[model samples]
Target: MSAGQVIKCKAAVAWEPGKPLVIEDVEVAPPKVHEVRIKIVATGVCHTDWECLYGTGKGMKFRPFPLVLGHEAAGVVESVGPEVTKFSPGDKVIPLFLPQCGECDRCQSPKTNLCKKNWANTQVGVLADGTSRISCKGQQVYQFLGVSSFSQYTVVPDTSLAKIKSDAPLDKVCLLGCGVSTGYGAAIKTAKVEKDSSCAVFGLGAVGLAAVMGCQAAGAKTIIGVDINPNKFAKARVFGTTECINPRDHPNKTIQEVLVEKTCGGVDYALECVGSPVIMTAALESTTDAWGTCVIAGWSETEAMNVVVEKILMGRTLKGTYFGGWKSVQDVPKLVDDYMKNKLKLDEFITHKLKLDQVNEAFDLLKSGESIRTVISLF
Candidate 1:
C-alpha cells in the first residue's frame, strides 16, 4: 500500500517569483495526523494563483521561493492519515485553502467564516506541524495556502477538504473550491441581495460573473456589469447581467457617478470582484445611500485605501469577505450538489481545457484575459 510511503509525482513548481512554473518531479510525503493525501483530478487556474505566483498576494511583500501555488481543485482521497475519520480512500474531494476547523471560535460563530486554526501560528509555507510535506530534488518546497492543488499529490488536514457527491464532475465542481463559491456567496450570503433589487457587479471576471449569477438566482431585476474590458460584457449578459458599462465610455464622470446616474441614485447592492482599492471605493459609492450594501469580494495588492466616510455616514454598509464568506468544509459540498442539479452554472465559466503540461499556457491565457476558467486535467 502507498500509505505511510512517500509518493513521487509531477507538479508545477514556482521556483522563483516573476518566472514561469517549471514542471518538476516532486516528492509528496504521506499525510500526517488528521491529514489526507489527495490525487488531484482537475484543478482550476485562478487569478489568486497568478497573484501569489508573482509574490504580490497581499501587497508589496516577498514570499518564500520554490512553492506550489494553487487552491481551487478537485481530487480523490489517495490515503487517510491517522485519526482522519471523515474521509477515506477513493472519496471525491476538493482541497480548501480556507480551512474550517470545527472547534474554533470563528467556525462556531454565524457572523464570520474566518477560522482561528488558520495556521497563523505556524511558518508561512509550512503545515500545522511547522514543516513542509513537499520536496524537490532533495530541497524543501513550500506549500501554497495549504492546498497546493498545482501538485499532482498533496496532503491537507481533515478540516481542509470538502467531500462531494460521487456523480459530481471533478472538472466542473472544482470551480466551487475558490472563484465560483467566493463570487456567488458574496452576493447571496454576504450582501444578502434582496429579490427584485437592482445590482451592479464590478470586474466581470469569473467571480463577478458568479456574483451576477447569484443576483439573478436571488431574483434581481436590474443587474449591471462594469468592467474596463468590453470583451467580457457578452459573457456577463449570459450570467444575468441586465446591462454593461465600460469606464472608458464616459471620460468625465467617475465610475460611481455613472453607476449612480444609471440607477437613478445608486444600485441597491454592489459587488467588487476586482481587487483594486479604487474599484472598491467605486463599489461602495455606487450603492444607494440609504441601506445599500457593498461587498468587497476581490483581493487587492494595495494595502489600504481612503474612502468617503460620508458614504457610510449616510447609512450605506461596506463589507468584505474571505473565500466568499463560506464555511468551506460544510458548504462546498452543498455547492457541488447545486452544480450537479443544474441549479448553478459551471460550464459557461470554463473557457478552455488543457493538460497539466500546458499549465503555464493556462496561466498565460488567464493573464491575457483570453480565458475565464481553464481546467487543467491532470489525469
Candidate 2:
C-alpha cells in the first residue's frame, strides 16, 4: 500500500437496468498480485452487456448495484501487480471477456473453453482469491466479467490480458476480445466446420457476421446468412456469405424451407446468434438430417423459452459455446494477428464509435439495430 495510491475515474454504472446508464466519477484500486491496471482504450457495446443490465426474461444473474459493466475491450497496460510476468506499463493489450490461466487443467482440455480455477472468483465478481480489487467512494463494487472496460481504468489478472502489436488499432481489434472470437470460434472450433460444408448463421449482428467469416475461413462453400432485416445482407456479404435469406421473404414457409432449398435439405451446421426461441427453433430446424450441428452463440434467459425437442429426432445436435470454445490467451492474439494481416474482416464489424459519455447513445443505436458494432473509446 502506497501513500499516493488513491485514484478516480468515470464509468457507466447499472444501478438498475431499463433505467438510463449512470455516468459518474468512480474510484479504482491498485493492481494486486498477478493483476494489471489497464487504461481502457475501447470497449464494444454487446448484447450480452445489455442483457446483464436488463435481466433476460430468462432470469439472467448479476451482482448487486454499482457494477461496472463491459467485457470486450482493448487498451494499454497502465500498471502491473507484484507477480505479473508477461506484461508491463505501456504494453498494448486486450482484456479477454473470459480469463484463463495457461497452466489450468481446463486450458489443457479441448472440450471446455472455461478455466475451472477462476470459477469461484468470477462468480462473485471479485478476484479468484475472493478479494475485492475495485471500490467506489470507499464502497466495494463488482467488476463485470472480470474486465469491466466501461470505466476509464480497471484491473484484471495477467492471464486475462492478451498483449497485441502496438501498431494495431485498438478500436477495431477490440471486437476480437469477445464478439469475433465467440462467434468465429463457435463455427470453427465447436462445430469443427468441414471444408465445402453448408452452414447457416441465424443473425447478422457482429457475432453472426463473425460466424460467416469463420465459415469462410473453415472452407464452407455455401454460407447462408439468415436475418429478418434485409439491410444485414449487405454487411453479411462482406464476411463471405454466399447467400442471404430474409425470413420475411418466405412468409408462407418457415425459414427451414428457404434454408433447405438454399443448402439442400438444411445446412450441415447452424449457428444461432439471436437469443429468441423462434430463432433457436429455426436454427435447430435448419440443421441437416443425420449429422448437423447447431451451436447456440446467443445469451438468453433459460426460463423465457421452451426447448422444442421434437425437431432433433433426425440426429441433429444442439450445443452451447462460450468465448468460441477458446482459451483466451492463446486464441485472441492469433485472431489479432489475422486481423492485422487482412485475413479477418474486423472493420466490417465496427459500425460506430463513441466515448464514455456517449455510451447510452450507443445503446440506443444497438436497440435500433442501426449498427453492426459500437465501440466506446475511452482513450
Overall lDDT per candidate, in order of appearance: 0.90, 0.83
lDDT of 1 by residue, 247-318 (tens): 999999999999999889999999999888888999999999979999999987557866889999999999
| lDDT of candidate 1 at residue 96, scale 0 to 100 | 88
For residue 295, model 2's alpha carbon misses the true position, in angstroms, by 1.1
Model 1 stretches astray by more than 4 angstroms: 55-60, 121-123
Sequence-dependent TM-score of model 2:
0.94
lDDT of 2 by residue, 1-379 (tens): 2312745888887666567788878877888888888889899999888877766345476466667888899999888888788997999999875777867778878778788556667655677667656676667778877778899888888888899998989989989888988899989999899999999999999999999999999999889899988988988998999989888888798898878777668899999998777788778888888998999888775545445666677788888898889888878888899889998888878889788888888888887889889988885
Q: Report clash pairs, candidate 1.
A: none
- Highest lDDT: which candidate? 1
TM-score for each candidate, following the candidate numbering: 0.97, 0.94
Local error of candidate 2 at residue 53 (angstroms): 1.1
